[model samples]
Target: MSTRFSIEKLGAQGDGVAQTETGQVFIPFTLSGEVVTAARERNHDRATLMAVLEKSPLRIEPACRHFGDCGGCAMQHLEEAAYRDWKRDRLVQVLKGARIECEVDELVACAPHSRRRVTLSARRTDAGLLLGFNRHMSTQIVDLDECPIALPQIAGALDMLRELGSLICATSKAFHMTVTVTASGLDVAASGSGRMGERQRQIAANFAVRHGVARLSVDGEIIIEPQKPVVMFEAAAVPIPPGSFLQATQGAEQIMADLVGQHLARAKKVTDLFAGCGSFALRLAKKSEVHAVEGEAPALAALDRGFRYASGLKRVTTEKRDLFRRPLTFKELNAFDGLVFDPPRAGAQDQCRQIARSDVPLVAAVSCNPVTFARDLAILLAGGYRLIRVVPIDQFLWSPHVEAVALLEKPRKRR
Candidate 1:
């Protein structure tokens, strides 16, 4: 027997919620107020999109052929505007749950098809080389013939590389590829002992050569290297490597960096934690002294380069420290009057705790996950910090992810 239910709220993982007579069931590809026929026997607790008996106004056709199976995109079925609204609503709910009161500005949304970087998994299967994202909630690999979000040129390369991987056999399991687009050309790196063999490298070389690519690197060696690095963000061209972290959208990164500059206007001695390639530090130096800290050594090297090339009155310093294990001490924290934290989705809970216990007067936290940000906000509030403002910045487009910057001020002393 199947029980019917209506979706009441959207869950954190982009699943629609329905209150069944027995319990709540989460069905994918459904929107709020969507009354769809769901098979409630998949996970023994009643979870399945049996049929879309009724479609909500918010429903839309997903453009990607591998939408349901590919794990990279979950909300492709949702209309673009509706998807942004849902994500903004979720952020509001999270802030309320954490007792942080603030107004939510218009949610910024990135373009649907502006992804310049993509990481695909390769597996040796009986059929051949299966190159694609893992299937949702399973280890199954979904073969993606074409990706709607990736750049056209990279997408073509993906198709060609898939065949090349299959032919080499040595490239089957050991191959991992990251495709990045620079202003000059596309950059790809295939790594693993047997992965990206001589034949695969030759294929990449020929593809770049025929396409008139400016740069190409395989297995730590440059085949068609450029004389200078290609700039992704303003005045700064990141010589991105095989495994470096970069914003997927070049246009969106410029906007994000601009927002960072605005947020650091009044900052004096600023500390940028989890600073990658000095994205915030170099720019922040135009307005204030910046101390950049990051865990990755290569990123630190890039940050140093950015600092050296930076032209201005403000000073810049670099520190390679792992905040996860060894956060800044009170004495260390006292050097900075303000801090700009751009942590990963994990959020910097331990570092937040440390900052809350310090005397820093101003803070600007850039976050990708609202839940973790709320958790960290609670700690800051407990330490006498008042929520100032929250600005949503859209970095990842067409996906459920939302990036936001929250400003906090220390409370006045009671005399």
Candidate 2:
């Protein structure tokens, strides 16, 4: 049945929420203050947008043709000012939920076509191979002709990658491919595809070379390596391992790094926990001696090489240890005057506990998940650390995800 709903607000998942007789109903692709006609699913509190009876002033035309169908982006219809405000409000709301109050800086916007890494889904069908992002909330692939959020090199290579997927697909099963545009060239990594025969391997290699790919790998096995994929971290040109973790956009990475470096400018000794490929460590080492710790051996090895090759950088040491299994103890953490940690989405709960107990004078916390970041910040607040400021960075662009860099400092006790 069709029902008229006045959208009350936008939910955390970028869905418009409406209060109905039963309860709140979430409708995708609707905006706040807009009267929308939607068909409610039977026995479900959700509705699909049918038409907009009243349009919102904050609503703008989405830039991409596949905006509604593709699951890659959300909130693309939001106006620039409204979108940035919404993202910043998300951070503020998350912190308030945890009973932590602080000043949140304005949202740092990332320009369009700035994303350097993108993961695409591919599936083989009777007609041909289907490659692009999966349909919204579905496994069906939406074949992409253009993506405005990705780098030109990556966006332009979609057809080329689709062709490559045809030669390497060993079965009718769906698979994942991650394409990263580095300083050298495109680094393509395909996984979940069945084993490749010699003939298939040869074909894949020839296709990669013809397309000028820096390196191509399947299931962590290198098929062809025309050149090492290198990514510049400040002054260092670090060679990235296949399928390694990188910041979604270089602009966001630099913003986060600058915040960390500026916060710990005076500290002579610093420790970087959960450092991935030395994004912050490399930049901070220009002024301070840095000891970077990470769980991935390959990432730490890359960081070490970056430090070794870079000129005029301070001493940088790396340790391969799982911070989750074995967080640095309070005593161990005391060795550094300053600390910076960029944990995964789950946040550094265990490490934050240890940091809470320690007396690290200066600390910078970088997180992509605001909920966990708020939890960790509460822990630090209980430990008598004052939050200086938090900057929300729109790294994922139209997506709901946001990155933040928070600075904190503990007062020195007088003897």
Candidate 3:
């Protein structure tokens, strides 16, 4: 039914909520107090905005040309201060939902084009090869002229990347192309591109060389390396594996590393759980001994080598283990004076459960998903850990995603 609706508030997923006679419906690209007409689907809460009868003052021009259709950003239409506030409130609301309230520091901001990494989708249509991000919750790709959220080097190279995509377009099926701008050069990794043969591999190798892409890997296999892809984590230069996890922005990373380092500065020994490429471990090692634990051997080896060559650092060790299946027992965790775990979006529920039982005096938890972060924090709170402060960091600029670092301390008596 096409009907007029008054937007009540913004939902958790960046949709505007409106209460209907029957129930509530969510409309995207809307703001609170705005009156808009939308087509509501039967038995569905989502509505497609048709027109805005009344506009909110908060609504502003989006930064990118492809704001609504690109699916790369969510809140680019909202005014700057309001966007930041909503992002910070996202963490607050998640914590409230988990019944864990504490001081949430102001959000650390991220700038446009600061995104050093992005994953693009590729496919060949009648027009030509399409290379860009997919539409929201969709398999459809939006061919791009420019992407304001990505680093200029990557954004400007879209035509080149599209041309290169044609060379490796093994099948009609879409594949993911993750491009990361490192200290050396662009590291391109394509997955699900079907099986690549010798001809395509050689062409892609030559393309990487001609374009000066530091490395190219398909489906976790290196196709070519014009130069070894390396990134600087604190003082260490770590050789990163293709498609390895990296903080979206260098500014956000430095802020997180600084927060983690300051939280555990007094400790003599620190354990960096789920440490990737030593982003926090090597930085912490300047003052305290660090044991970097990660699931991927390549990531762990990269960390070890970064630590080995880096100067003026304390002792650093590495362990390859999956914490989700085999969490460090409380007995094993008690050996560390401090602990920091930066888990993936699923959060670190299993490890946090073990950390709750550990008498480790200090703890710093970092996560990209607030929902799971709050769930894990509740587990720690139940085990007598005091929540100190949670700082929300804006890593994925203009997107709904936010990063957070939660600091907690176990009581002296408990230790």
TM-score, each model?
0.86, 0.98, 0.97
Residue 363 CA error for candidate 2 (Å)? 0.2
Off by over 4 Å in 2: 413-415
lDDT for residue 198 in candidate 3, whole number 0-100: 95
Tens digit of lDDT per residue, candidate 1, span 256-327?
667667765877889999988776777677789889999998787877776666455478788999998998
Cα-based lDDT at residue 216, candidate 2? 92
lDDT for 242 in candidate 2 is: 90
Q: In model 1, which residue pairs have backbone atoms overlapping below 3 Å?
A: 40-46, 231-237
Candidate rank order under TM-score: 2, 3, 1
Q: Candidate 3 residues 106-135, lDDT tens each? A: 999998888999999999888899998887
Clashing pairs in 3: none
Question: How do all the candidates rank in terms of lDDT, highest first?
Answer: 2, 3, 1
- What C-alpha lDDT values do all the predictions have? 0.74, 0.92, 0.90
In candidate 3, position 266 carries an lDDT of 92
RMSDs, each prediction?
Answer: 3.4, 1.2, 1.3
Residue 66, candidate 3: alpha-carbon lDDT: 84
